[model samples]
Target: MPISSPRPPPLLMNLSLRSADRVSYCADMASKLAMDKRLDDFVMILESNGSDLSVLVGLLDARMVSAGICGLICEGRVGEVVRVFRLVEGLGIGAFELCDELVKAVLGLELRRLVEEGELGEVEVEVEVRRVRERLKRQVVRSVEHGGVEPTAGFIRR
Candidate 1:
């Protein structure tokens, strides 16, 4: 009897993605990169603090806290803003001071826009922006003082 040759290994098939699929894949990659860009900048900020921030960086990746902050800011939700500030504070960053400075920048831009359009007087815009900023600061301070934030599990090493 003639010896039978071993069955040939199955051929590996190449994925023949359609043009639509290729376009979708590219869009997905672009979105992911955009999200990562923010996190990369956040990491750099943390690293500048003159300590081994690798642990915080790793925790941030696990918790995606920055994404939550971005979402809250985009929605302009008042209540969630305190929680976002607390998250930053819990990570050993000075959230209150940073938020104070950021709010000024935001209001400055808004004030400039209002002046350009003649929608409101400079005094009115300044008063309103300052009022809102102070309220936000108080809320954030209360949250931090009261330990309102439930610590993220990423901070607790196994």
Candidate 2:
């Protein structure tokens, strides 16, 4: 007899929101959706995915009003959400930290663009660079304190 492979899991559809307002609206809809008996089945399916339930919490934070709605949608089934939250909290913090890095990258790119376009004189460029560096240093320090990440030697070197 041939060995059989396990079937693949079902794909979950990502709820799409066109705008921030839509997030709130959808969350309300999710609350209504939760009242259905099917919700329990959905929760079971979600749990099987091994996804960090914290992602749902992060989504709730991302759409503040939606948090309660999400809880309701889960039919007050919080165990999976709690488990996912613990798993995803660190990743969420890292992602939050990366937002600052993204701002720095954008600023650096803009500065480079200005130089390439001859829109900034060398002296102005130097001054702007210094200013940006100082601002970044202050921001990095604040981020380190806020995020509880030690300033890395590489970051200090830069």
Candidate with best TM-score: 1
lDDT of 1 by residue, 22-85 (tens): 3344333323432453433443445443343433333333223434344444544323344434
Superposed by TM-score, candidate 1 places the C-alpha of residue 56 at a distance from the truth, in angstroms, of 6.6
The candidate that achieves the highest lDDT relative to the unseen native structure: 1
* Alpha-carbon runs more than 4 Å astray in model 1: 1-51, 54-71, 96-104, 107-158
Q: For model 1, which pairs clash?
A: none
- Count of backbone collisions within predicted model 2: 3
What pairs collide in candidate 2? 53-84, 54-84, 54-85
Whole-model lDDT, model 2: 0.42
The sequence of per-residue lDDT tens digits that candidate 2 reaches over residues 1-158 is 99998755532233343444444444334334433423343234324334333433233323322343243323433333233333334344332221224334444555466578875475365555766887889877987889866777346462
RMSD of each: 16.0, 19.9
